[model samples]
Target: MQPMSRKTQYFTDSVIRRMTRISLDCGAINLAQGFPDFDPPQAMLDRLAEVSHLGPHQYPITMGAPNFRQALARKCGRFMGLELDPDTNIVVTIGSTEAMVDTIFALTNPGDKIVMFSPYFENYHAQALFADCQPIYVPLVPPKFNFDANVLEEAFKQHPKAILICNPSNPSGKVFTYEELKLIADLCIKYDVYAIMDEVYEHIVYAPHKHTYMATLPGMWERTVSCSSLSKTYSITGWRLGYAIAPKPIMDKIKQYHDFNTVGAPAPLMEAAVVGLEMPDSYYEEFGAHYAHMKQLFTDGLRRIGIPFTDPQGAYFVLANIGPYMKKGQTDVEFCEEMARKVGVACVPGTSFFMEDVRDIVRVHFAKKDETLLEALNRLEDIKAKMA
Candidate 1:
């Protein structure tokens, strides 16, 4: 038989998911995958229960269920400050994972170049490769996770087809500010490139650091394809309901790809998630407050344990430097497995998220309940002795 597609050789299975499995095997507290251990909003749960018994169990429209799309348009338009037409601007997808990949397929041809920052979500690299596109990586300097404008302009000089921006970035937890975003928008306009935004953590941003929708920037409304999901905001990751909003022209292509891809997001789940989309502004305020509490709880414990880590402005993940605990010549991957087994805590190795030669940093999330985080911190207190 012929060998499998060469694209499969470019990347390994998801290290984030691998660490989750290792955590399960060792009975460790899982800080590897970024999912909350608590229940979703009670209202959504109740609505889901009702939807299960009442209909729409089969398939909805290929674009999306009408009520879901309308709710999404109203909610997103209010926040994004844009008038979105449910019929023309939205394509519900099977999570932002599919939303992103479908947007890539719709926007670029094979061998096109895409710009992305280092220490990005692991899925972006794989998505680019799967689409037969090359990624031009621009590093976000550590401690602050800021990128140099000159460096970014240099990548844009390569005339890449699109640039993927993950606001409230994963693995590093840096939230891009408005001035920073304006710099990118200016460059995108100058270079005539598309901006594919992964804004899944839009509502989870910390205070003093706001999420600026890329499409909201002047001259960007036409060129930006915004992809997000109900997973993080609603704490319903298992629901797998996500959507992309773009101009009608771009969305027509994305809708075509989505139609042939998954046919549509789960019908009953879409019907149920409408409650989440229709939630009031106060709901998001409380949601952000809850995450702020979790962030404070986990980071304060790390400080008490004398572990140095990057204090995130947004997103729940933190990059902790465990260089002091690493054995001589030990890779982050090996250290992570050993830590999982011996210390009863799990985290993703930093190498999984970086393009540069980086080790000694492990990414862990604080999205769990307070008890779970406290337990993980308690186990981590003796990490130096146990790993040494």
Candidate 2:
């Protein structure tokens, strides 16, 4: 009989996915997880249908199939304005989840310190622990989620090995502005720290707000590891397609880690998704407009229901202030559970996304279809009556 590793003791199972299962059990409309209940581009589906019979099902090159990496490098260059050598730069992964862990493992040794923002995607916190490292948490002041540059500099002085930046961040959906990115980029360079970026929402940014690649920053390409996925962009969350783009030195190690951990992302799936990677600029433009429309529809619904929430600049989740509804002794978790079972809508308790005590908010995603949003809102309208 033996005990488990101490590293895992710092975290538990994903609260987001857990709530999703609970939502399923309660027969609630599951807005708890961020997967879209819509179809991906027809081009990808058609490609998949064709590729299925062609059969590359076994495995591809360790880092990625040649064509896939070429497509990715071309896409990255076209979008980010940087020509990347696919052979040395990209490590295709089983979703950004793997890309992140791979980067963490490849770059940091146990006991190293890594900088992370508060109210981050919950997985980052767990991954820190899993990587046997400590995170220096810098708070992104709420209501706007802006950070104090001075405060961030203090965190960097802690001599952390790297900073994990989730631009167009999750939960809060606060896209880091160019100035903020410059602040971070400056701090990283000054502190001689690496920047590990999660840019999965690169294409999901709302207009008037834009996503800037950290790797494209002056003198930062070599020090920044850009990790992202096709899940959110292409609506193929189930495909588990993700990757890390770094300079050769870093990517060499990431590739070694990824190769042993994963033979490679599913071969046939990569072949099909390359079609999405090569999509026209108009395709991405329409994508942003579609999400903008959904965001407007859902947020407008919340306002009509008289619920207070922070507006998202990018990504699809809204962090609603449900403080008024937290009855005498009920915690956000209890309120969320009751909302799912009785109110018939499911959401993740906001506490899950924070490093500090944050229990007045719950996260809901607007990546669903219009009909689904309408139904969720209609059910939410009876919140007071149902909870009372």
Global lDDT of each candidate:
0.94, 0.92
Question: Runs in model 2 with CA error above 4 Å?
Answer: none
Question: Per-residue lDDT for 99-161 in model 2, tens only?
Answer: 999999999999999999988999999888888899999888788899888888999999999
Instruction: Compose the digit string of candidate 1's lDDT tens values, residues 1-388.
Output: 9887888888999999999999999899999999999999898999989988996899789999999999999999999999999999998999999999999999999999999999899999999998999999999999999999999999999999999999989978999999999999999999999999999999988879899999999999999999999999999888899999999999999988998989988899999899989899999999999999999999999999999999998889999999999999999999999999999999999999999999989999999989999999999999999998
Residue-level lDDT for 116 in candidate 2: 93
RMSD of 1: 0.7
State the displacement of the C-alpha of residue 226, model 2, in Å, after optimal TM-score superposition. Answer: 0.4
The 10-residue segment with the lowest total lDDT in model 2: 3-12
